[model samples]
Target: MMNDKSLDIETAEGNAQPPHLNFESSFPSENTQVQTNTSEQRSAYQWYVVIICMVAYILSFVDRQILSLMIEPIKQDLMLSDTQFSLLQGLAFSLFYAFMGVPIAALADKKSRIKIISAGIAFWSLATAACGLSKNFIQMFLARLGVGAGEAALSPAFYSIVADLFPKDKLGRALGVYAIGAFIGSGLAFLIGGYVIGLLKDVNFVVLPVIGEIKTWQLTFMIVGLPGVLLALLMILTVREPERKGLKVGEDGQIVKASFKNSVAFIKTHKKTFFCHFIGFSFYTMMLYSLLGWAPAFYMRNHGLDASQTGYILGIIILVANTAGALFCGWLIDFFSKRGYSDAAIRTGMIGCAALIIPSVLFTQVENMQLSFALIFVAMFFSTFPIPASAAATQMLTPNQLRAQVSAKFLLTSNLIALGIGTTAVALITDKYFENTVMVGNSISIVNAIAGVLGVFLLYKGCQYYRDSMKTENLSKS
Candidate 1:
């Protein structure tokens, strides 16, 4: 039998009325406080779990980002417009990815997170391979949707697991290490995608056993996607679920699993902080996804570079610049935390938002290609700080039972506004306002400037709200 404490609160009004929580006096739990010991050093096993999780993250991004590098060919093969291609890259994946995260994360909060993550890796990997089988726009869109739905299961659970594994002092660095997978995967997607495109640019088609002939791009998807299945199996077999920490307990000494509604209630209590966090990060990511989605097209159209060359260059930049940035940002958050800054994560995010703007906009506006690349390198470096910072911010503030759900809420808002709207916005501007494919560079600059400015202003305000919210909660970190 499972622990009774994990049961949802049983009240006359059901979940609509959350169990009484008095943060002003103490944490919401009836008796027990959070169980994690901040002084304990993380073990070797914990590091292993983090490494496996990072590998899974790497594969997820590879599947998601590879499509960006194949835009021209996919459009040519499927007779798609720029807007239609953007839908496949942005909306089709993000719509389901964002919407599905809540229910999956709810399960993460209550069930075995290890199993959830493994299953997700398997599902998305297969979904990615399925994208290779698509022969039409509708088919591709559906495939992308499947990929999104499957990937929706990852980050929230990973964040929850990592939060349980490490102390608050070390949480940012651990998560920052995990965040490296995103850029690594993105880099690999471009590098491998570019290499494959170059290798097979001459080969028209190849015959499969039962499936008949397939395009080179189709083969590439299958190659990248199928390996994740084995990785999923490895995760299921090797990784053990970490103990849930900082959970609420009732008067009878049973842990209380916060209902979805309870999670919402907690969020409502700290609405200002969440509002700034969700919107600010969403806009920051809007700039990021826009650049990632369209940069290949920009280089190909404006700079007279082919797919392979652009991919190689961009891949190197992401691997070096973005990876370093993520690690530094993680360390930076931990540094701020150690120095008695309650708003460390938000403060770090504000710095990145402010620093990245000039370079982000100027990179595209510049004439010299090498100078443009240098600016891109600087922008890319600052762009990564928010990834770890945002996760650290949420994990530090929320109680254990509600961590995954709250993180999911942030993902839903961030992905929708960033990936869905932000990416599509660029395509719309290029297709309608500019009415010229070569003007995509301008579209990137405009979107970057608008999003960057908003991110800085909101995060600036968020620091104050975060500090206010911290005062109310009895966080372990404090």
Candidate 2:
């Protein structure tokens, strides 16, 4: 049943080798290339790489989402409308985060992923600090764009690198831990930003020699942004790029690189899996950012809570529930696989999607603050439960050279739709459709209910395709 072109190769040490990066030219001799392919020869530093990559991911979200907590200050400072602020939060950042990902991901497929990651970490971290320096709309928008572009470099490379470092059986869990970074960074953005702003609320703005006066929110951005720069140095000095694995090598032993046309062509051969996967998650993301971007304001408006109180409650729920969901289900994917469920990740994702619907819809419709928070908390956990499994499944389906590019495609579609449309949909329903700000809760309910159902349908349809891909993979290995 195996595709003849997809069989495993033998290593110089006489052991079966998994598909790996074509580094034939770099090796200079066939014997050297074969020797490095052995599982026993893998670098001992792999787990450290995963930990640090997760840190970078955490920092990316912190830099990106910090604006969520600082919305009121940004509005007051710029004398801006809600539309203008939303532009900064959604469109401005997402444009770069989406388009810039492809080229960077292509580079990761060919060059030093470690170097790419370090440079990205430094770029985004510095860009986040620069956000504090901007005095006006155009300047701040550019800064946010820079943050997006820099973050675009991280996940594709990290996903590709992580897959090679972790064996297939363990990849779901490793990626699960990596996926926690997004939620962690998101939660911490609110926690750290709220705490910092609260601490500085009574203090007068400080005037610096060149930068002039800085507000409390501005200072918060600068302080949180600097630590990631230090972390970038650790990545460069400590992490070694693992030997690439699970790729198709050519007859001459040359690792063929993916071109845009070819990659699309290859993806089409498995269009059902990719399309269902992309569209499903995109809708899932629509529901997610709808709550995330608007929920704090919703609480403050309806429940008589202040910014600090809203941040504390939402932050704790996001961190604990998302972390638990990602870790537990990620491990569960591997566990199911070992128990003869070849499509375990897809099954887990389907379950998460189904579970997410009711809680996601009800959380917004409820009037009681306690009930609202509890519903949303359960929704957040289930919403995130699918990410690690989806990520690992994507890697399992793609070849080594194409992994980053495909992963980039994954991020681009999900974020562009999520950040671009998800937030806007809720706003449109409230501002345009109902013509009443008080109906924000109803708007959230309508949008999430539709999107959550669609997400469940697509993920369910994609399950068999994921299983088919796994069978193809197993056949290739045999």
Candidate 3:
């Protein structure tokens, strides 16, 4: 006879065996085991979800940027000052979009991200259409506010979704692909706006009791706004909710709730990465947003080009340069990561890009129109190349759990300071020096060049923090 403990162990091991594997069945089916493993992998549809999220992001950007191309026509019709126009493009829009993003992103962390995104698209699309109906500065300002409110839900929620869908190693490429939406949507806005305004230059619609005559600019807003409504419907009807990774299951099998305080705590613990990304992106946005918001008007006034011509030329440049920059940065970051030089890659790329920006901007102020445009294209290409690296750096520094909130925090700082203040600063400078467009342009260039230099310092600091964090993480794992 066997001892009690040995017999008990044998009995427990025997009980652990499945009935099919027991004497009741001589052999178990290999097909059944393979089917279970396949189901596990099928549980998460990562790439499909990334594609859908990217589509929603594209619509968000198109709605925001359509106004950039239409600014000239809108300014002419409304008789608006540069200061007022800047308000519409920057502060009026970015104020709500920046502040509202935090809470909405927090909600995305807790609720269904797909639902938040769908609702946001619908709200903003309707608001864009409402912009067409505005009779005065106040009405247009309010419409822009609505647009901002809707857009606030997009980036953070999308970032959260992307983080969940892709592994750490693949995230740079994933974000690069997603960022293409920004370039494509912005390019399409200018392309479509130019064509529509060109086609409808003489066409006027006299309809409705309250709204008598509608111009092409007004019609442009209405037409562009409608498509997002359909996109919103697609988002709501088709997209399945993804599971929130790293959540704990309780005794009753429900996901244990994560607190906002806990989220803040996580960020506080990683403050170095948080601040570095915030400043680097903030500086980058200051330059990009100001340029995007003002470039059309700048070209129209200084280059003596019609809105349609200016739109086409600038649109083509931005489309090509931005797309290439984003994709290249993504590739470089991923390439360097495999060699254990992720931080070094980001630091070198951003610093090099930032250093070139000063000269690039000065060159854009050159007297020759063709030369200026050519130089601006080069400046834009280099300026935007580091964007993907900055994005990846932000994602790498934060814990996976707080990625969305951290992104929101980064945007809040970047947008409020860069997008909000940068555009306004350029507009104010232009207005003060309105008598001398050349001087005005030079002033704007100087401000941007200084901001670019600051960005290099911030990026370098971020790289150091990233390396230190990686070391700490490695020791923890060991």
| Candidate number with greatest TM-score | 1
Q: In candidate 1, residue 406 scores what lDDT?
A: 95
CA displacement after TM-score superposition, residue 318 of candidate 3 (Å):
1.5
- Candidate 1 local lDDT, 113-161, one digit each (tens): 9999999999999999999999999999999999999999999999999
Question: TM-score of predicted model 3?
Answer: 0.85
Task: Name model 3 segments beyond 4 Å from true.
Answer: 1-45, 204-211, 246-257, 342-352, 385-387, 433-440, 473-478
Judge candidate 1 against the unseen true structure and give its global Cα lDDT, from 0 to 1.
Answer: 0.91
Q: Model 1: which residue pairs collide?
A: 5-254, 5-255
TM-score of each: 0.90, 0.87, 0.85
Model 2: per-residue Cα lDDT over 16-123, one tens digit each: 443354656554687766776753445446767888898898998889888877777788997765567777888878889988999999899889999998998899
Q: Model 2: runs farther than 4 Å from truth?
A: 1-44, 250-254, 472-478
lDDT of 2 at 191: 89
Give the winner by lDDT: 1 or 3.
Answer: 1
Q: RMSD of model 2, in Å?
A: 10.1
Best candidate, lDDT: 1
Task: Select the stronger candidate by TM-score from 1 and 3.
Answer: 1
Candidate lDDT scores, in order, read 0.91, 0.81, 0.73
